[model samples]
Target: MHNDCAECPADSPDDKVFAVFWETQSNCQNLVGNPHTRFLTHIMWSFVEPGEDGTVPSEFQYWSQEHIKDCILQLRMYEICIHDVYTLKCDVVVVVAYVRFGFDGIDIDDETGNMKGTHQDWLTHHGPVVVNYLQALRDGLDAIQRPDEPRYLLTWDEFPSAWDPPDPTNEHYTGCISFHEDYDGWHRCYEPRISALVDMVNVMFYNIDSGDWVYELVLKDTLPVKAAAVIPKNKIVVGACSGQGCVSDQPIGQEVYNAGNGSAFYRGSNVR
Candidate 1:
């Protein structure tokens, strides 16, 4: 969600969402009385930065562990419904809540404002390191799951361009199309191994030229491409942005609508 978290009307005839990355810049207090949040199954506390040395920290850097745990308590009492059309008439579904931690994979160099290493370095070196780090984080989250509550979620935000416009020249390049043109080489390095570690991935499909491209990415490219790489369709979430930073009309509202309808459509049928 955007920084203006409280502005969205409750139960509007818009797309329903499965989860949202609540920007850390937005006030958490706005969530307490907001009606629009009733549609959410998960709220991710975004942008907890990974270490420069490629490690995931046990504690959060953006907020204290206790503060986030308190926020999860606030989320425990949602009135989620089975059908968005009949939400007001539907039976109240007591949603079990847990905090979702989202991470960005890129690490920057302090001195020259460049990536710490080249694309090759990330593929051949840091890729395995990231996989191991996420595995440890997953193990930690699994350890904390209680019988009464749902397990905490670990998610990743990736550039939508990471898996598109099929790159075939390089030996390491996987078969995926190129959206950003120059990004095809980088797509070769997107580690599919990390897909199994995280609960879901939010592909940043914003600021592009067309809503159809976003739809095409979510439908034809993102799911099928990642599926070919062994990342399941259920683990992929179609991401969009609202308000200021994102351009208007670029994100197809129906993408989010389709995502929340059921298991996303891939090939001919619903996948889980």
Candidate 2:
């Protein structure tokens, strides 16, 4: 889902009321409870970074720790839904970053709209910053965790390739999730890049009114299947539509099952 600090003001009166409700339900009796208790962590592996002529500079970056902390505090204070229940189990924190790729410049007919290119062409042109970001974030997360510590879940929202105008067709679009081809390219590029670093991979399967086939294809046709074909089943998490606008309406367990295709695909697999 989306995270909007403005709509859900963490320090607002409404947020305070919900925060109290959340603390009660989460059994957070101690004020000094672990910060992890208040957050469901997801490591964000891609972000929108400004680029020049399809080339990303080495300087630009994603949100920093202070910014993230502010976002989290706001999330706890105003934006999160206390009655939603998912938050109670700390099922929402995600660490987000970006990858960069640069491609040989080419021109296409804006009028004809004929598309032709290999996935490799697009990926190399776009730059591999997203893949690199995933690798770094995974390492950072791993370095931070203790041996016995339960790992915080990791997720990646596929980077958008094109900017869509605001219109009826774009109502369901956030200019975020795109086509399966681009997603496949990302998976192919990223799977091997971060294979050893990450414990799981969650791909965004929602944007507008898309159906389950796309999600199924991602699992059956992409990462999960491919990973199994190579190594053992890799941990793959899917992002399904759960009716909640900014957050998921389902509980954490239900969301996990939804991501796992009703517990059929990843069932008995190590990726979960």
Candidate 3:
């Protein structure tokens, strides 16, 4: 959604870096005038936990549940949804989401070339588990979406694709989002095959707290580059954190970048 930056720059007046602010620590008043508010193209109300053990994860959480009813009431008070989405502009911002969970350290069985006996049973079959999970979400959203209205959104944060593959020579079977030989040397979980269901994926590039200065990680072309290597740049957003122990140089990417403060998520300078 576009914001009214009346005197914004001519070349890139609407440059966006999607940011996440916790609902617990922030409110409408806290955000409206924040310095970083202007830079936000999308605001992900974050860390919304899903039902911890469901086959098809449910978006209900005891801690964050009240906000749904309360937010609808707030919308009623503001009378925002009376207008259709196309006409509403940014007057009413809404979102429905599923945070990516339990996606890590998948072992490809040597014989079968799979992660045996799990939802992500194999290298490539992992796609259907995610595709179906997301398609279910899409159907739910489509059911509620008003005619011609912009969808609120169904998005998630994905694990970084790779974690130092054992065989970088062939770059085979790197877990998480890495380039694997199984799917023709692309991210097993993040293929274009699921693009129809997923709207967006946030790649966390920082929190390399155990490593060197974040500047070394970002400006020098490391994690962020790895993230884009396997995932489509258009469907991805880069996230960063303020480096407490380390600093970084400039960054370069086609994806939207948003780095938050130490307390917030994502911290880094803008990359044009």
Candidate 4:
């Protein structure tokens, strides 16, 4: 029912955008061999969180000797992963950063009580931090030299699913996934505002432990429908979570039929 040729700005004139959300530790060999990766225009690394500073840390941040060794191992893994992506087919691989905001309705600050910046109040009072966080991400993307042709994206995981420091009596301790939790007011057209810096909003829309029926509803209706109305259909990349994280029995790929919001890939229950 939607137009596949809808004009959107992913830096690609064609709208046949197929994006995939991949877990960092997934088997790189399996990924490169999969038919899916051969056509992905975007590859997103999910569940990646930054330090308490809520910004991208420099390479030197891993200062300690042990930490440096660990960092080297991780870097080698990523290097291999990125190399494979380029050899197969991929426009860009974006790193998903988790916003440090604790909760939407109550608080999203650091769990250690060090920082304070509720998601709901970010746009009004603490907007600078949000901007900085996003800017840091953009800078990192801009510096990518492997793919040579890389695209940038701004996205975070489903943070509102549960809070870190759960309280026994706090009513905000529910496990429900809050839609637009930290972004209740952000469901508007952002073309002129940030389309230049961000290629698309990768919605990490899976692995919420939903049943088959619930998962289908969200895949086909709940999230995408609402997102399309607020943001341009072309600017939304549907992300599927996989591996021990998802319990839904739904199949791996769930492309929204008749929807022109580009293409989507499902990932759950398995890292690969």
By lDDT rank, best first, the candidates go 1, 3, 4, 2
Least accurate 10 contiguous residues by lDDT in model 4: 102-111
Q: If both were scored by lDDT, which would come out higher, candidate 3 or candidate 4?
A: 3
Q: Candidate 3, residues 161-203: lDDT per residue as tens digits?
A: 3323334345444444343233433123344444445544544
Residue 115 in candidate 3 has what lDDT? 35
Per-candidate TM-scores read: 0.57, 0.36, 0.50, 0.45
Q: Candidate 1: give the clashing pairs.
A: 164-177, 164-178, 165-177, 165-178, 166-176, 166-177
* Cα error, candidate 4, residue 71 (Å): 16
Model 1 over residues 173-244: C-alpha lDDT tens digits? 334322233332323335688777765555545434455755665557555665446666556655555545
lDDT of 3 at 14: 26
Q: What are the per-residue Cα lDDT tens digits for candidate 4 across 1-272?
A: 01122222334433544544444343455554444443444343323234444343332221332332343244344332221110001111223322111100100111111113333333233334434544655676456424644343343322212222223365653122122443342111122233334445444344444455645555566444544454455555554444543434435553343122234422111121
Model 4 TM-score relative to the real fold: 0.45
How would the candidate models be sorted by TM-score, starting from the highest? 1, 3, 4, 2
- Expressed as tens digits, the lDDT of each residue in 1-272 for candidate 2 is 23333342232211111011111212222322344323332222112233334443333234343343333344456434322111101111223222111110111101101113333333353325445644554565556665754443333332111212223355453221222433332222222444444443334343322344444444555545554443234344444443342132333343445544623553121111
Q: lDDT of candidate 3?
A: 0.36
lDDT for 152 (candidate 2): 36
Flag regions of model 2 displaced more than 4 Å: 1-122, 138-155, 158-191, 207-224, 230-234, 244-264, 267-272
What lDDT does each candidate get? 0.44, 0.31, 0.36, 0.35
Error of 4 at 226 (Å): 2.6
